[model samples]
Target: MQIHAHYNGAKPDPYLINHHLEDNRLSPESALKIIATSEPGGEAVGLPEFVFLNPQADPAPDKPLQYMIKELFVKETFRSAGTGRALMNWVIAHAQAAGCARMDWHVKPTNEAGIRFCRSFGADAVAGRVSFRLMLR
Candidate 1:
């Protein structure tokens, strides 16, 4: 997975996934949760498809808390099946309902499809913004 590959060449932390599942992060005030289900039984299909977001702390008091989309992805086969839109819609709706001033996410410039998808939702790319990270290891 891209996340696995990005973590300093180390595997993803299982504990983190467990913590996400166990926490209140999916509550209405936090982030919306979307789960793919099986056809017949309607059980969770699981894996390779999910969106994770959280309330972002905005420094500006005039702005309500913002929601940050931390991770979003759909299974390759389900890419165009409206799954991504559904997940995004859920997040947007909940964010608005939670009194968030805005929603934000980071997308790679080379991810043309992702850029288009975000644009389709009326998202604008902010100018002069860059992300930096320091590896503690």
Candidate 2:
């Protein structure tokens, strides 16, 4: 079994990722387009987002640093194969190597799997929720 991390834009599995995330308009292109169109910085989006996946390679960093996990999803078929754990492991190693004192994750409370998996990574909820009302049309 082999594991790799890569940008969706450059991978052969873009098709797979697109297919898996398509139902809810979760394609990487659309996501990037959204980012590109953001007003210089950006506003908050409540939707679950994945910034990267199993990257096979790493960027050349002169110092210790962990790559940020922009978005995450558990592929239905790979749930039992430790894919999620592998991803977290990559994060841990990256952070440790990057000189970060600790790593963090933000998962919705309703995401039981995400919650459980994060706990498995020794992630404790240091803070609770912050809520507000939106006057959407």
Best by lDDT: 1
What lDDT score goes with residue 70 in model 1? Answer: 68
Q: Where is model 2 more than 4 Å wrong at Cα?
A: 1-68, 128-137
Model 1 residue 127 lDDT score: 85
lDDT of each: 0.65, 0.48
Q: Flag regions of model 1 displaced more than 4 Å.
A: 1-63
TM-score of each: 0.64, 0.46
Q: Please give, for residues 1-137, the per-residue lDDT of candidate 1 as tens digits.
A: 33454434676678875577567555556445444434366633222223433334445455556676766766556677777787788778877777677877888888899899999999999888898879999
lDDT accuracy of residue 120 in candidate 2: 75
**lDDT of model 2 at residue 31?**
37
